[model samples]
Structures are given as structure tokens and as C-alpha cells.
Target: MVRGVVRPHRVLSGSWGEVIASNLDYHRATFRWKCEGLSEAQLRRRAVPPSELTLLGLMRHLQGVERHWLQRTLAGTTPAFPPYKTYVTAAGDEWYDDSDPTPAREVYEDYVRACQESREVFARATADTARIVPNTEFGATDVRFVLEHVIEEYARHVGHADLLREAIDGSTGE
Candidate 1:
């Protein structure tokens, strides 16, 4: 488990691909920081009465996001170890379903591992690498586009994570 706030390497100077990767890594670290030192109850706490979002849920959702985009979309194959598959099978809204009794640690670990796998996927790719997102409206894309989209996804979710974390413990930071 991550012991404390992880200082992601600064992206002061790099190629376009390196910069994007660094930014994504920063967001991933921030997400982990937001969920750190929280109990299962706190991790599972919804922000509002009707909202299903929770720190744990976000972690699971992001896991699937990384796996789907990189492993499935980019690599054009299914993830060897599909994150939250069992929960998804049981409930269509597995990411938001708090009913599952899965441990918070497991969810966090899965997310971290998925992020690592995503890194591997990108390491084997170049900014200009041709890619076609199957079953999507867009016919074709490239590694750069996928990287940018993932960064945007993390940026949006990190905001949600900030709110959720604050509601859980009144803690806040980038």
C-alpha cells in the first residue's frame, strides 16, 4: 500500500507523449492521495443522499476505465484480469453499487494495478501509433488522442474525488 503522498515526477520538459503520461500519472497519484487513510465506511460514504458516488466506487470505475481504454481499446483485447468483473456481473451499476461487500483495499489495489498495466500499454506505443476504437462512433484515433482522453477522464473524476474525500473527512488538497 502507498504509505503517504506520492510525489509524481515533474513534467518540466519532455516530448508530447511524455508530458501527457506525466500529467496522467500526477492525477492518478492525486486520486490515491484522496482515498488514503480512510476506513471502509468512509470510503463507501456517498456525498449526498441520492448520489451513488463514493471513493471506493470511483476507484473501481477508474480501474475499468484504464483497462478498457488501454487494454481493450488500444491493445484490441480483453484484460487478462478484468477489474470488478464479478461485481459488474452481479450489478450492472457495480461501480456505484455500495451493496457489494468487497474490501476497500482490494478495490484500491485493483485500480493501482490497472494503472500500471495502462502504463505498460502506452510504453509500447508511440504518439503516432495508429489505433481504431472498435464499436465507437469515431472510426480511428491515435495514441496521443487516447492519452489526452484518459487525462481528461482523470481530471474530471479527480474533481469528484476531491468532493467525496472532503465530505468523508473534511480533508482537501490537489
Candidate 2:
């Protein structure tokens, strides 16, 4: 568990990479805070009827997102995490399927680890570093685009998490 207060990103001024990284780091910490101090059952509770969304699922999904974009697309290699490998082949809502029986601690730990690895990937990349995104209409793309896309993705999901967390236990904040 992260001790003490996790400081908010001071996005006043920095390089392009620093700005994007700070924003990404902020969102990542926000997501973690939203999920803190929840039991396994609480984490797995669905948001609404007929919806599979859960805090646990969101964490798992973000883990996959980090691995796919940072490890696979940017680094051009397979995901190092075995759970993610299983998720890629699992049928029917792989990320949200609570039937997998994996421990909530494992899921949360994977997310934290994946975020750290993603920071490393970004650290090695400059704004202009080019990486070929397979199956995209536009062949090669720059690191800036990937970083921006990650920020956008996390922003959207964190919004979802806010609602889900509030619905679960009435706790909410940025």
C-alpha cells in the first residue's frame, strides 16, 4: 500500500514529456485512491443492473491498457505479465469477468506495476520518438500521440471509476 499522501501533480510548467507524464501520473494516482480500502467483494460489486463494470475490472483493464500501449505497441514486444496474456485469450468480457477467481490484491498490484513499467517506457522515449502502431491507418506515430492517447483513455475511465466508487461506498474526490 502507498503510505502517506500521494502528492498532486504540479503541472505549472515543464517540458512536453514532463507535462504529459505529470498528467498521466496524476490520473494513475487518482485511480488508485478511488480504489483504496475496499474489500474484495466491494471491489467486485457491479455498478448497476446488467452492467459488468466494477472497480476491480477497471483496474484490470487499465493494466492491459498500459501493457498493450507501452509494452507491446511502443516497446514492440509481448506483454510480460502472464495474467494479461490469459486475459487476451479469455472469452467474454475478459477484463470484467469476475469469475476468474484471481485475488483483488493481485489485480491491484498488477495495475501499480504496469503503471511503473509504463513510466519507464515513457522515460526512454522523447516526444518525437517514432513507433509503428500495427493495423493503424497511419503507419508510424510519435510518442507524443501515444502519451496523449493514454492520458485521454485514463481520463475517461477515471470518470467512470468516480461514479462506480460513489455508487459503491459514497466516497468521491479528485
Candidate 3:
């Protein structure tokens, strides 16, 4: 077997692809877990001015991402959950959230639920290299691309979340 290629009909990985995919999943899950236990106001508070990179907003954004990649792209289905257009801007305005102010409990519940749904979708597609759909950026895709991108996206926001949460009340770490 090639060093980076799968054994075919089985998945034993001395492979770059599988390794990266595994790491991606780890980081993505870590990002979600890190935001737990913060309040709604804390999660939604804009730490940096002119930037709405709140933990709640990140949750909503990641929900939209999961819908796009796993549902729309992979499953080829319409969004099962509501779209989070509240934080989306028309253009050049990445930070604009306008959702109803839910209690911390409610917000956390929704975010956690979304992550569960996404996990289901990811698990259903058996192959890491399964080509669910084409992405504009990644172009041709396997599940690996989706997994990696999700991790990348979440990692970026998690760093922001770390700072935001720390600024709120001095709590930190994953």
C-alpha cells in the first residue's frame, strides 16, 4: 500500500489524509466544548468593537456551516434547521447579529443540539474520502475536506471565543 493511501475496503491509516481528518474532528469538537458553561450575555457579548464574534453567534454560524456542508452538500437536502441570518450581513459587514435575546439555557441548548445533528450527518457518510459534493473553495471534495474546513473555521472562531470569554469574566482554556 502507498504510504498515504488507504488499504481499500478497510481503514487503517498510516496515511496523511486520515490523520488530518482525525485531528480536524478533534479540534471541531473541542471548539464546541470550550464554549459551554458561559451565560447568554457572556456568549453574545461583543468583545471587540465593530465585531460580533460572540460565542452564540459562532454557534449560529457553525450551525449554518453544518447545514451547508453536511446537509446541503453531502445529503443534498434542504436545511433541517432554521437559517441563522441574524448574524449574516449583506456585504462587508461580517458582524451583525439580530436574533432574539434568548436565555443562556435556551441558547446553549440550541447550539448543543445543532452539534449533535451535525455529528449524525458526519457519521452517516461512511468514507472519509467520500465525495459528497463540490465546494467553491475546496472544489472537488471528499469528506476529509469538509471535516478539515469545519475544523479550520471553528478553530478561528474558538480563538476569538477564548479571548471573548476571558474578557468577560477571566475564565479560560478548553
Cα-based TM-score, every candidate: 0.84, 0.83, 0.70
Give one clash count per candidate, in the order shown.
0, 0, 0
Q: Please provide, for model 2 over 1-174, each residue's C-alpha lDDT reduced to its tens digit, 9 standing for 90 to 100.
A: 343438476576888777777888889988888888888998888976577778888888898789877777776667776443234333443444666688889888889999888888776644455554552523567666776777878999999889988988898887
TM-score (C-alpha, index-matched) for candidate 2: 0.83
Residue-level lDDT of model 1, residues 1-174, one tens digit each, is 355968598587887768777888899999999988888898888975577788887888788778877777776656865334334544444344566677888888888899898888776654455554553635577666776777888989999999998887799887
Which structure is stronger by TM-score: 2 or 3? 2
lDDT of each: 0.76, 0.76, 0.62
Judged by whole-model lDDT over C-alpha atoms, candidate 3 comes out at 0.62
Root-mean-square deviation of Cα positions for candidate 3 versus the true structure, in angstroms: 8.6
Q: How many clashes show up in model 2?
A: 0
Model 3 lDDT tens row, 1-174? 001212222224756555644654555555555565666566677877777567777766777676777667765667666533454466744442645555546555565566566666654553546655677767877776676676677778778877877787787765
Worst 10 residues of 1 by lDDT: 82-91
* Candidate 1, residue 30: lDDT: 91
